[model samples]
Target: MAEDLNIHDADPVEEFLPVYGMVLADPALYHLAVSVGETLDRGDRWAGAIRRQLTHAVAAHLLGTYTRLKPAPETVRGGLAPWQLRRAQDRIRADLAQAIDLRAVSESCGLSVSHFARAFRQSTGIAPHSWLTGERIARAKVMMRRKDRTLADIALACGFADQSHFTRAFAKNQGTTPGRWRRLMEPEARHATMP
Candidate 1:
């Protein structure tokens, strides 16, 4: 359908159909669509004016999709009984800096420690200590990206015992040292335009 339209011919009408189709297909085009529309409209081309309108219309459609895709906060309302586990998870997440007792977490869920340990593992696919470690590691990754903090500070903040512990844990989960991981995360000059 696109080739039959000979959109590459650059006739305003020909350009309109394919460009309009693209706008309809992927409306999250950042500013590219708007800029194209403005540039075309400024040229005083009839097709350009039509394109601007079509672009805006398509943009509106994409906006709706984008808003819908905004990830909703995980909620416990109207869900399975186990959804209350979210509260327990949230509590644990909040105090990631402190030592979490599996017994206490189970009590929060109103389950016996042993039962909760098993069920929580079944629900989340990992033991509570493992899950807690993963969450702390994830938080540490975020901290490592900023220039202000030292590795020692990040380890302390994320509740690890010390630098050696943090390094070993980070290596186990990420398969690389923290320094190397941070280096890899740095942008190459050629890809500077990326988000």
Candidate 2:
């Protein structure tokens, strides 16, 4: 004599009992659930299909987690602020090997020179010039590792003006000369790579 319940109200606890039980045992089903959520959000049929596949993957992940197996570590939280900084940082990073103007960096962020320097230092915990120097040195290290590049070339490419200037700056910032760093990175690359 009772009215029938709709699909959404069909005693989900009872209906999902089999699924929950299976997922609990499998420890991987949670990933499948997360993927399904993502797929639904993408607003594309193909995404939905991909989500269906990921639903299975999520299930497997959940199964592993529930079982106390080696579930993947949680991803670090990233947010919009870092993304905004990344856009500006990309420009700075690209021009590190050149004569970087602090004013330009500030202008890029729509701030005046002094205001930009202060904000940048506050956010990055280093002065803009220091940050730029570090970036240049990091790039030089990458170039030095290639072995095809000479210390002089690296110095020039990294905007040190001359080999002596590069050596002094590298030593000041990196605690070693460019040549020494390259040797430490690749002992075999010594003669063949040096200019």
Candidate 3:
């Protein structure tokens, strides 16, 4: 069966079932199968429900195996789907003032935390936390343009814990403290407003 499916030793499948070819190729379906397997292994109270889901997934996999030999061009191989990426970005941007919950974001995209993190990094060329930090810094820069907003306000708004935490992160990324950056931007802001 494995030889027919072209699956090798390195493939993620443990049992080498014929239907696994289609299921493993599809990330969402693969995740569901793995989750169901784990739940069954743990002997969940809802074992019957989980087993029914597993049956359905296996049936779908088998149907797909016979029906679709060619892989979809848009199918996720290593990275997130466009819609998943957009959803994650939107979720992250929706509440920059609050601490980012990676698990929540991953769940929102119907992915496990580890898989989502890997796919996200593969797609964006950076880890999710790094991306979030970059976004916070970008937002802080924009907020700094306004003289009325204090550094503490910018920090909190950008999801930093406090002024000191924000200062450390800002300096690490920008090579200057938040206060200095603000001071540096003051001239630019003044020059722009003057004309």
TM-score of each: 0.55, 0.51, 0.55
In the predicted model 1, the residue pairs found to clash are: none
- The lDDT leader among the candidates is 3
As for lDDT, the candidate ahead, 2 or 3, is 3
lDDT of 3 by residue, 68-170 (tens): 2212224347898878987997898788877678999999999999999999887676688877886788788778868888899889989999999999988
lDDT of each: 0.63, 0.58, 0.71
Ordered list by lDDT, greatest first: 3, 1, 2
Q: Counting only residues 3 or more apart in sequence or on different chains, how many pairs clash (N, Cα, C under 3 Å) in candidate 3? A: 0
Candidate 2 ranges beyond 4 A from true positions: 1-84, 187-195
- In model 3, residue pairs whose N, Cα or C atoms come closer than 3 Å (at least 3 residues apart or on different chains), thus clashing, are none
What TM-score does structure 3 among the candidates reach?
Answer: 0.55
lDDT value, candidate 1, whole model = 0.63
Q: How are the candidates ranked when ordered by TM-score, highest leading?
A: 1, 3, 2
lDDT of 1 by residue, 32-74 (tens): 5665656763656776777766775555444434321121223
lDDT value, residue 170 of candidate 2? 81
Candidate 3 segments exceeding 4 Å error: 1-77, 188-195
Kindly indicate the candidate among 1 and 2 with the higher lDDT: 1
